[model samples]
Target: MSLQALWNQFLADPGRILNDLALFFTLAGAWLLLATRRREQRATARLVPQNEAQAVALDESTARMNRFFYRFGYGCLMLALLVSWYSTRL
Candidate 1:
């Protein structure tokens, strides 16, 4: 189909598009959270800290990453919820 046709279709019913956006964000957030958790677990399992300082540094780094990823993933989920709610009001 042509771009014009797609645009017209979208204009006719934007709720469908918003629903799709919500689904995409929901999946993306869940996948990001799960993938990063698995990756971090595997990485930490394979690494061995030689000293107390090294262990502390590793722990700090992991905690920092966990915070960032969790925040971003939750943000995506919140965005998806907002989009879904907005679509329902349409």
Candidate 2:
């Protein structure tokens, strides 16, 4: 197809375009985060030699937050995929 025709086709379904963009960006961000995540950095900042209990709590909290972010990122990616696929098929 010609460039102008492709552009027109894309413009015909803004929802499809939006879904594609969301899918790309969401997965990209998730990949970047997973690639560079640093739990030790966060945990070290909260850990204190004088307070063992506080240190344990801080570690647990940090781990929980990390797990949450990972899950959220994966969820966004899956949602994006579903949206894109549904939009394209219709």
How would you encode candidate 1's per-residue C-alpha lDDT over 8-29 as one tens digit per residue? 9889999998999999999999
Number of the top TM-score candidate: 1
lDDT of each: 0.86, 0.69
What is the RMSD of candidate 2?
6.0
lDDT of 2 by residue, 17-39 (tens): 76777778577757846753665
Q: Which 10 residues in a row give candidate 2 its minimum summed lDDT?
A: 35-44
In order of appearance, the predictions have TM-scores of 0.77, 0.51
RMSD of each: 3.2, 6.0
Model 2, residue 4: displacement in angstroms?
22
lDDT of 1 at 17: 87
Candidate 2 has what TM-score? 0.51
